[model samples]
Target: MTRPGGTTIKNSRRLKVRVKTGKGRTVSQKTWLERQLNDPYVAEARKLGYRSRAAFKLSEIDDKFRFLKPGGRVVDLGAAPGGWSQVAVQRVKATEGKGKVIAIDMHGMDPIPGVVIFHKDFYDEDAPQLLIEALGGEKADVVMSDMAAHATGHRQTDHLKIMALAEAGFAFATDVLKPGGTFLAKVLRGGTEGEMLKMMKRHFESVRHVKPDASRSDSAELFVLAMGFRPID
Candidate 1:
């Protein structure tokens, strides 16, 4: 028998809670439960008052790449639950009156201090311009995208959906990023192929894929980091 908070279970295949007994066991449900209970980053995120463990994912990724900085203006796409926005707000010291963070999501978010949040579909024709205006008409120093489409359990379909989101994110970056600015977006494990990478290569001086430690080991998610924008005329 384990006491509450005594030896927090490490991620394992067998640590799942069965809601209904007998032979109805589900592999995905088991994996998810075990992973959630055992994830150290999740615990740390709670302790540090972050909205989700994903905050630490961004933190770790930015630690390696150093895209976010003091006094830097940033935009967070798909900023629901505000974990990434919380991280950005703290890193840029928006509370200290130095920098700004503009976050958008289709899902509603409880207000995060020092972060400006917009509830709307990012694909709406006027949304990007509205975000720019909300930032007092300033170009962003960094743009981060964690937007992912609802999974349809079809691997190829999910990949295409996520790639489309990334492409839209890149388009926004092209419009708003300063010459030396950075763009980061969540991608699948193997990185985008063919025309996608080609397009990123043309627009940014360097592009790389990173898997932050805070992300679950089994997750296919990774981030695509783009540095030094070269927008087409």
Candidate 2:
């Protein structure tokens, strides 16, 4: 549909650029809204029927690495709003009865077909075991973590918090992944090339850091991809 001004209305949803004349519109909030409005992934997400644009980050990363496969068992850490969960379900064919996806997050998530979601903290004493059991006693082939701490606006502190979560996710993956499995987690640039990298190198055949195109260029976030898990003890 084309409007009188010759602009296409492909989606038909009203797109607005509301400017505040006065009050209730802070500079930061306005900037955030503008960014969201202009983001290509956000627009593509709506057109592709995804819950959130973050889905593209996972898709792009998986596309390059080919970590997800049909009939593969996967665990999604920090899954919320079912964005990544949705993609995992379709890619792994969990709807066809050949695979399972166990998603864990502290936040409540709307239901997604072919995904078993656990609304609990992954660090809870029994959460890891519960997720493993929910997979019907089968170890996971791929463990993916998109967990991030609530940013405190302090750069150093925020970095440390995200690293802590990544470490916890790594620990859970190590406990439940089968030999030759894979682990992927979000981390800051400063978080890698340290003790965590050393530990990953010892446990996996290869560890690579990736920044997907969907990720913001200014963001400090990157993903750590660990392939070929080697179970110790």
Candidate 3:
């Protein structure tokens, strides 16, 4: 038996909904489904009309860091499903003409009121140029990414893939961010590589790793936040 603050389940009156194993459903899939069904964040996301539970992760981060400011120019890399982009639009007041937000991802998403969307992969040669053009040559105040490469079940392999994405996002951030800009990207828990950490330290006054409470405790995910960017001429 479960309740979302005594909330009802989707089209159901029962507080505790059970999923019995079916003929076609595998054990692992059944387990995953059950977890999703009961997850408070999932329920909350639905209630709030957020695309995914990931919206809370970014919202939680910004709540503490206060980086998504009004009138700021922002970019969101690999922003599909538009959860983070939605939050950015609200915080920056983009629809209200207070700021601009550009979002790009390989997969297309429905339009968000205040975000400029680019339906292309970040690794494409044209991606950077597109973001630059969208920004109208203005430097970005923040570049944030929650993108993750497809996970292989192997922990080490998955870690390496995510780190690769993080490193790429960092490189892109370096080119696009204004002086004193902020960069936020997801990384694995093992840690950011020393060389990359050193490079970030050189560019930003403070570089710290964050694990928001919204993240699942069993997951090794972390976010690297670099603030007060120092652009080298």
Against the true structure, whose TM-score is highest? 3
**Model 2 misplaced stretches (Cα beyond 4 Å):** 1-22, 191-193
- For TM-score, candidate 1 versus 3, the one ahead is 3
lDDT string for model 2 (1-233, tens) is: 33222333333454565545358878888888877887766777787778887787888788788878999999999998777888888789999997899998888798888999899988899987898899999899999988888889898888888999999999999988999999999999664437898999999999989987778889998989999999988
lDDT of 1 by residue, 1-233 (tens): 11113423233234433343226658777666666666666666676788887887787788778878999999999999899999899889998988899998998799999999899887788887888887789889999998889899887788888988998998888887888899999887444544677889998899988886666777788788899888778
Candidate 1 runs further than 4 Å off: 1-27, 190-194
Question: For each candidate, what is the lDDT?
Answer: 0.81, 0.84, 0.85
- Residue 57: error of model 3 in Å? 0.6
Best by lDDT: 3
Question: Compared to the true structure, candidate 1 yields what TM-score?
Answer: 0.86
TM-score of predicted model 3?
0.90
What value does the lDDT take at residue 4 in candidate 2?
A: 21
Q: Model 1's lDDT to the true fold?
A: 0.81
Query: Alpha carbon lDDT of residue 68, candidate 2?
Result: 87
- Give the alpha carbon lDDT tens digit for every residue of 75-133 in model 3: 99999889899889888999999999999988888998989998888888777777888
